[model samples]
Target: MNPFELLGVGRDADEREIRRAYTAKLRHTRPDDDPEGFQRLHEAYQRLLQIRRHQANQQPPVTMAAPVAPPAEPRPASTPTSVIRAEPVFVPQRLDIDAFCSEAFGRAATGDNRMLSEWLQEQPAFWSFRAKADIGQQLVRRLYRDEPAMPTKCLHVLLNFFDLDHVHAGHDALALQRLSRRSQLAWELMPEHRQALAARMNMQRRPLERCLARLQRPYTWWRALAAGFTPNSAKVMPQFIRELAGPFIEDLPPSVSQEQIRFWTSVGHKNPVSGSQLLFMAGVLSMLSLVVMLGAAATTVFSSQTDMPRLALLGIGVAWACGLLWVALRYYFVLDEWLSRDEDEPARWPRLRLATVPLLLVIGLIPCLLLPLSRGMGFTFLLPALWLSLRRYWRRHDHEGFYVSPGIARIGLLIAIVALPISPSWVFAVATLLAWGDDLRRHRKVLQLAG
Candidate 1:
């Protein structure tokens, strides 16, 4: 089947258009009337959205052409299926060792040096990841000997080494204090390599900064066109960027400080091809789905003498139901994010978001809804909207690299306005409008608490 038809929008529809259609459709479905069907619609919508969003950003496309079955490497019969052993291989050394050790550890006595050498040898990541270069190792050995005049960078390296590679030594917490210490001892402990790493990261920040500026809405009239028409696009990025970048965006620090956010954002934004690809594909599929639904709806309205429109609506709704079911099956992984709260913050949003789920489900199942529209049409419109509202409210604060800012109230208001006049359509549209509006209110309450 054409992916476009699957999403319920027109071909070549932009992200906003696709989003509008999706929200409108899912809002119509009553969740309790057919929970299983509602779930399928959600899944299809999620996957398609991810795909299109990546495409819009000029990222690489992800194809699920054949279920992407994992490579069937032959395994020993006795090996356990669940055992996991991951080892990082192929990481490059970034620090200069000769200067680090000579400057930092040269001041120490032989006995003190000997103790530090043993400690360095005990770090597991060094051995497992093979991150130890000869120069870095030599510097590490000297630091064990109490090297003098060690740079603060050298101290930072040791701190990272201890924090990331040494757990059993019980020095993890000490590393934090060591980093924060405002003394000569701390400065001497810093390694030259860490300084280099920081410098390199600083250098890498410019491109991400540029991309951020380019992607921000309202910076340029017809911004997408401006981005698309840029000349000499030989270096144009691919579309699969979000597959690589979404997690990093989620990981960015939530501080309001511009400098801090910039530093974190630099570390997160990578290749944009995946992101572009997701956006494009999602836009296309959703648009196509919208076209199909609209065409079917129009046909039903014009062909009032026959039950063809009803049957077509039923068909569209079934497809949507299947989509929601797909989402439900993968709900565990996605749903868990909604429950996660920042360790420093009181996690009010997560609590309220969870509390609203049952309410959504109940509101999702007003009997008046299904009586007017068949389950299939309901699935197409209602399920996607519900999931989008839930996801938006849950992850409202995450917006660094991936484009997660969806106007929930705007979408709700649009649905409500469009829903009022229609007869049979009112049931599906009204239900969706209510769910989205409720979600928006809940989101506002949490935002107030956060403020």
Candidate 2:
């Protein structure tokens, strides 16, 4: 198609007419409104300019009629009447590279964003091609999944610095979509969190939500087991961890349970990474430990029995011994992550290793180990580890009425757990019951207020 027709100009249309027509058409064909129409308009604008330049170069210079020099001077050389002036080019203006990032990032947390807005005003290139998809994509990468992202108010100025926010097309326009357009892309607080923040910050009644979703899976045996074995959960776990993967425990609202907060962000984050593979294996081995002890007891209980199945017991002992490497590997991963927590990438975690699983195995097996050696020594040996786990549980629940069973009651449960050879299952049972109580208390309190 003719450049002249594209811009709705005559072939002889000058640069001003073409530019005017292009600008007029541009208003009707914004990138966000119709990307294809905008593209065609932009192309027409460029093509018309190019054609004009080519014609200017090819046109003979307008020359004055040579003066009839009456023998005063040799025939005067032809002189051009009009000089072909080059098109005025608007060079993209940019901020100082050194201060560019420092200034923008410094305002990330603050309300005053005049530095960015004012700077953007000075830079005209973003309107042309500077702030296109490539830069927009890079900016998206710089955003945090958990930590408060750049202020949305300031983000608008930055994204729109080059009117390209509106004129960009296709993938480019999508990349540069206004963060303000989607509440999630802005500073959305979680439901419970939003209320807490507004009360704390003295915000108006308007909804205050945009912060990232909390990544939480309260510890449950079923969750741990399923996460380890399910193919879809395995893949999704990693992705969820990545999206809400930062350590923002400090940023949590006061309304949230700190004890539960600690679990979700710290131990909970590690769950998917640990993959519970070792835990699963430990369960199988520990179950065997329970079974063999039960079988031997059954024979003894029913009749004045043959000796305890020493051979079978010894074989299980061997299996348990062999499984030490499995246990060690699990510890290796958990300890590695524990030590590396300060430095490792938040999104990356060791597969098939878990801290609690190993802890449970060790706690459970202590009693089993001593069972053969002495009539009651294993339970005695297991006392200290169970106490320590319980004490830690209480400390974490400092948030509210997290259960810390009285020592006597726990000891009673411990004896039962030991007698049954269920080991860590008791630990899980107590925690689960405690968590249920905490939730019940929380909901009941809310219901009382409503009533």
Candidate 3:
């Protein structure tokens, strides 16, 4: 099936367009909702990603001309009997197999095989065999043709050369299979070659080590360990990190800095407001608010006086409102920056969302105005207002995956409202702890990725 058609995107669609389409399709066909549909969608996404990587790795087309035979001329009439015939001179040039093998090794070490292929084409004896055997077989035969004692280093280099050629050739599956078979034959001829092949294959499998090897400036052992645990490292680094690792093993520029790696590990797989750090902050704020409310309730309930301290309660209420406002403002700016950087969708209703935060804050203070009526009445005013605020926020940002914290926070508020008459302190403490736990879970995942 055509993945582009399945995803409803053009073949030339950018990364953003592909991701957006995938997310939109996911909403309607959740795995639990429609397992078959979700499976198809997931397969299409993976196929497109592979297609893109293949296209990126493919080299420019090289054109070769077929060799043409010269036209035959009619033999001169038998007048050559009277004249002396000139014979063509033939010289036997000795083939220095060792030097040729050494040169091929050097070119392979540089990670480009076009030079080696060109050199082989220039040799008349080998040029005829190029079409008869695969490139790997041709190289192996030439290296061991006359040399009884092939150095281990030359054998190792020959193995690496074949592997690098296959990777650079857009990972053609059939070509790799043929190369692997030819290399295995070479390995069987020499026991030491098996060790070389095993070492080379291991390096290819662990991309983090390969990337570190390409670095011009050596990194500490700890930094290399950290890179292994980065977000999406398992999926991306092994196969595709080489694309980002600049050409030329020596004098290689630092393609990915340590700081960039750290940043990607922390937030690469996360949406703006849904990131573990942001969720943790939201949870902490919710818990603090609940603690202050519960403290005020405890003070009122245990006091001997029938009337609570109005001025002190008012001060606590205002301070709490200001703290909520500050948290809201801080979150808004942080989310704005993250969305601007990562989101492909154009800014829509962000100002409106920011404005709603302050509006909710103002609504939250309505309970303070009603405080003069009765303590129960003031607490009652907060219930519907908090519910409305939570519902609105969820509906607005649910598409961005920011609904979890708000959902948990709303549940906590409901518990506080229900138990306000009986034991506000105890109930609110339990509710706030729940919110904190939710955020803590998200935060732990981010830390794991960062490590």
Using lDDT, give the best candidate's number.
2
Stretches > 4 Å off in candidate 2 = 1-81, 84-88, 113-118, 124-149, 162-451
lDDT of 3: 0.47
- Could you give the candidate ranking by lDDT, starting with the highest? 2, 3, 1
- Winner on TM-score between 1 and 2 is 2
Worst 10 residues of 2 by lDDT: 207-216
Query: Residue 401 of candidate 2: its Cα lDDT?
Result: 51
Give candidate 1's error at residue 311 in angstroms: 26
Q: Which of 1 and 3 is ahead in lDDT? A: 3
Q: Candidate 1 residues 328-383, lDDT tens each?
A: 54454444454444324555465565445445444445543667745455454456
What's the lDDT for residue 64 in model 1? 48
- List residue ranges in candidate 1 displaced over 4 A: 1-218, 228-336, 340-345, 348-351, 367-370, 377-451
Query: What lDDT tens digits, residue by residue, belong to model 2 across residues 1-451?
Result: 5556777888778876776676557546667778766666676676667767877899653332344646644454785455542344334355354354445555643545677665544433343443444555454444322233354566666556433345542334533333332322223344533454456445443522311222333455554443333324334433433343234344433333344333323333433334355544455567667678888889888978677788568868976887786666556555444422312224243232213333544555555556465524444434433443444344434565555447645765766667456554445445434433433343465436434
| Better TM-score candidate (1, 3) | 3
Q: What does the lDDT read for residue 299 in candidate 2?
A: 80
lDDT per residue for candidate 3 within 209-285, as digits (tens), equals 45444332344444443443332443454333334322311212233344433332343233343333333334444
